[model samples]
Target: MTAQANTALAAEILEVPHAEAAAVTRDSRPLRLITCGSVDDGKSTLIGRLLWDTKAVKEDQAATLRRDSGSQNDLGLPDFALLLDGLQAEREQGITIDVAYRYFATDRRSFIVADTPGHEQYTRNMATGASTADLAILLVDARAGLLEQTRRHATIASLMGIKQFVLAVNKFDLVAYDRAVFDQISTDFKALALSLGVRQVTAIPMSALKGENVVYSARSVIPWYEGPTLVETLELATLRSGQSTGFRLPVQRVSRPGESFRGYQGTVAGGAVKPGDSVAILPSGQVANVKQIVTFDLVRNAAVAGDAITLVLDRQVDVARGDMIVSLDAQPQTGLAFDAQIVALQPDGIVPGKRYWLKAGSRRQRVQVEPVQQLDLKSGKWQSADMLQMNAIGKVHLSFDETAIFDPYELNRGTGAFILIDPDTNNTVAGGMITAKRTELGGLNAHEGRVILSLPADLAEQLLATELLASRRDEVETRRVTTSAARQLLDDIDG
Candidate 1:
């Protein structure tokens, strides 16, 4: 058979031979990414450029940009940053204050890019964006080099389990697009990333405003550089391989629109799922088989990592939004308590014994701050403390009212990340991840007390026996004589 015939046959088999109601095809996989950097570092501009240069932006949106071009302050060019400045405050302040989401696709892949705020005060926003991102793009200014904020952002990203990083040295035009400046920034950032436990770092030089080396290569400008452009790097980047040891799906919604169908919808947190796959409903541990996976129109026999679908079960099961569906073979963890490292972002310090809302994936539970360890950003040591201050990175012990499925932040990014919100104010004060468990009792005792306690039997005997033992013996004899005298006097009086 011809190659085209074989291709067509394979496509037909994928569409038909599989259960017509549930099919597995190649068109469903997508990469979820988050772009993070300090404010004014061109994160929004880069994303806007990526969309425009790739023709991902619609004609009407492009026309809007063209109409607003005359009002632009910078060179009277199309203000690409306008594409992401969704809020009035953001446009006025010229900074992204909250997390903004945008979707675009290429022929080979689709993307969900989260544009996060970058100010020191908005670290919680950055953490929220980074928690679910498979890849992180860290933008650096060529003129500024590696600032403290850059290091802090990278550290937070690494702590959030973002393994893949793309370091885009933006504003190359400001530095005259010098290769030396780019190399210096790249080397310095790489060293910082290595210390932060980042797995891979790819550095690319680009001018986001000028659209140099963004979607296409800037051969004329940077002839000395031989690597791929920012777009090319994203396109060629490898997807994370290896099946998840634990199967987890956080139930986002449950639907039973009619008698013909009943389904639970959620993004697959980890591992794989298929029709007939045995899954355990979390918080209850009831077992059932996946009957079918359904989306808006596409129903799939199987859904792997990152696929958002509705699952129909073989047996009637008690499942609800915020409850987790996990594989029986790889059961999800359930406990009312766990430990996490939280970066407190609110001005009011995190108080102990205060109830805060813990949001992990689609699950939210009431959790209390049991204890706050000291901020470690300065000394890199966990010290004892009662509360966490703004911009403070510290380890905390949190106790939830109910148990939920969780993975170590080191293992699964989707399952292991969480945030702390003030229950009364509904303000997110801290963002954290479960690093390790503080299982030992009296764990905080070691950090307290100015002097050490030593109860040595031999030492006690040496001091007390030599000084007080002899004196106490005479006093005991005197007390016994007085008691005998008192008894003799009482007998005489009775007689």
Candidate 2:
């Protein structure tokens, strides 16, 4: 190649499409991750090692860590857990209590790590961290192999839609770098991950305290292991793609900066939006056209999921906070009854037929919950349950007093996820996801109510052909059952 060929190649590279280039850059954007495992599984030590080796912690912070380090571990390093377990109580108790977030970077990629508490009591905090994480690092003690808490953390992470998993078999040094033990643990964990429908799992043996196989390679120590280090797996891990199903902007607030300016402000939860796109105000079904997409910087022609902007509609409409602005062609399900899966976070648990404030996005409404079943973590079976105790993952029915808006959690997490707040204490008692809209009226089509007829089969056919019933057939459900079945159903009715 000549100088002219080189110049032409440079020009071609410079002419790469802005959108395509931006997308590639976005794909490589910092990955958000969470660390979770049983208590004393060395979650903090792993995160601290990552930060320390990656040079994320500043010198002043290191000095403070040394000053705070009452005693060093056998590895001649400061108590790495101290670097993350920031609370005074946690330091005293020698366990993490709250979620500790830290940022670090390498030349290949950047990372935001949420070091969640490993104790059973702080399972709620772990869920909070998993909600926004793209990957989960589940730590396990090499000597202990897999425990119940380890199973619980993995289950929660899986339920929250984290597909990527890294099983850090920590404290390998304590187990004398036993390859057989590592293989057994990894095999069992892979089985668990497979059961959870997580196909992407990378297991590595490491001694977090000794800084082996975390940011650095422990290849010499664990000669049998040839997998990438913790940091390596993270750097190559895929970021959660923009898997939104439809355009959704849960209105956080309606902005009326001046008489001429009226805008709906919120982060785009799913899909993309641009000027002139037809949108529907959810729960109301009111339609409007986008006139402009405004941001503090400038008027944007388009905005995709995760962009926070103000949308100015072409006409005035009744829009408010908690209402979702969505694409008209693709609308979310709106119904009074829905089925959900929840993790009971409170000590008193969730009671059947109890009314709680269901808050999703920015909207809150009264809802009655009836626990249907509780998931058995060990067996992976759903046992019939009327009440869910603390840390219990249960399925339940949520009947709203008014119309509830949602998408299935599998389709769009932002639109389909919610929390139940205790009306008496105003505390968020449970985090849940909309599984599906319940269609109780048993008919070929879903309808609001059921109408059973005890007439003769011939008479029932004749009734279906009548003009009044024919015209409104879709609006009502028709069910035909034996007199004995009807009597049993009537006996089981709550009234």
Candidate 3:
């Protein structure tokens, strides 16, 4: 693409209402949340209520939902789940079969809620949603208390790095909104969550159908309950404050038009950027200076995390999509070998010696599964395994064909996560998180020698001729000895 077109694309992505620019920056850093539960546990209903009560739906859409209510036809509740259940089959089945993403904004924050399926068949889908989430909301039936599915969801969430959990005791109205029932469920879930290493657990008694304790506190029924409502607690929740520790922007596109302007465009994954900042382009180790920061309708002297802007460098540099722009001081390790935990979705197992495409950030590389260390779910202990089946969690060692920048998933979400794909089919097979890097023996100072050996053509010919002559001489000496023996025998006979 030309430089001008590239600059325009960047500007278009970054352009917003002046008031929205600041608001978007503050809220654009979304809180990824995943809802987990078993089928009929009201997972979909709770999500629908959260969106409806938050006033996220447009008036016309709400009117359509109201018009379409009262049928259990594929779409569960025509009013609430319709906002997220976009698929025809999902609407028909009245059950979520895959992960549904919904975006909404409140005065206090913006959220990307990942509504994951509850059935055992879609457990991998739930893991995919949970892997990138900061918090998890696990729904429990007030009548049933804690079920096996609840523990499984919580365990999966803990494994995926979700530290905060809210055990929402849903459908309290069925049990007459009893405080005793709510408290007992809360206590049971708390113990289970604690055992799973969940650091924070907040239990709330809610009735999604009744719209109680969801957006506003249900004053009449639960007068004794004084805790914050679901919306209020979410708004007050503390977010991680250390998101700006490293500089990382995966180049999405590169442009140079007639040599007038040349730069790269992508959303800032982390850290800050300013004029004269020294940045390195990954996989090539090329360095350049930030000459200017250009957006479509505005020019900025600096940009920070979440900003989408084109970076014009002082000198022409060879950069492209799949390359990372990083600060020199915080350059990530570049290599072919890395470690990751993969959650496989298909029934077809993931085996060693198989090649797959790995997409991490904006970089895509051809990767081979080197080995499967262990399956974490069945045994809860590490054991040797050959392949990962559906809904199976395993640690895999992967080797890439080219060098790529990466961070540990625990450290940086933007740089440390990736997806595995089948090269021939181009189907996404698994989602992975970089856990560690393979260390070479003898540290960084190890060395090996390189040399080549071959004989000259003339010398080779002469050696072959001399070997043939020696063989002929040996044959002649044997024949002469045989003739002498025969003559001696004849002389003895004549005597």
- Output the better candidate (2/3) by lDDT: 2
lDDT of 1 at 151: 71
lDDT of 1 by residue, 1-495 (tens): 232342243344333423532332333456768887766899999999888987888999999888865676566668888899889999889899888888877665577889988887887678778776778899998888877667777877776667788899999988887877877887787777765556477688898888898987877988766666776556544555325546678999989899887899888878888888888998988899888888888887788777888899998888888999988888755776677777777888688888888999888988888655664543334577877778676667777667756876666667777878898788888878776444435555335333222334566456444422321222222222354566676677669
Worst 10 residues of 2 by lDDT: 1-10
Report the C-alpha lDDT of model 3 over 1-495, residue by residue, as the tens digit: 332342343244334333354444355467878899877787777778888888888889888887867664443545567666778888888788879988877776888889998887788989988987888999999999988778778878876767788788888878988877877787787777765556477677888776788887987897756655777556544554326357788899886765688779998877888999999988899998889998888889898777899998888788989898888788776787887878886667576789998998777888998656554543244466787887877778888788868977666767878888888777788888777675554654234332221335565446435522222221122122344566675577668
TM-score ranking, best first: 2, 3, 1
Q: How would you encode candidate 2's per-residue C-alpha lDDT over 126-186 as one tens digit per residue?
A: 9889988999999999999999989989988987878899999999999899777877887
Q: How far is candidate 3 from the true structure (C-alpha RMSD, Å)?
A: 21.7
On the 0 to 100 scale, the lDDT of residue 458 in model 2 is 79
**Candidate 2 residue pairs in clash (backbone atoms < 3 Å):** none
Clashing pairs in 1: none
lDDT scores in order: 0.74, 0.84, 0.75
Over 4 Å off in model 3, which ranges?
A: 1-30, 58-68, 71-88, 91-93, 195-197, 238-244, 371-383, 442-495
Candidate 1, poorest ten consecutive residues by summed lDDT: 471-480
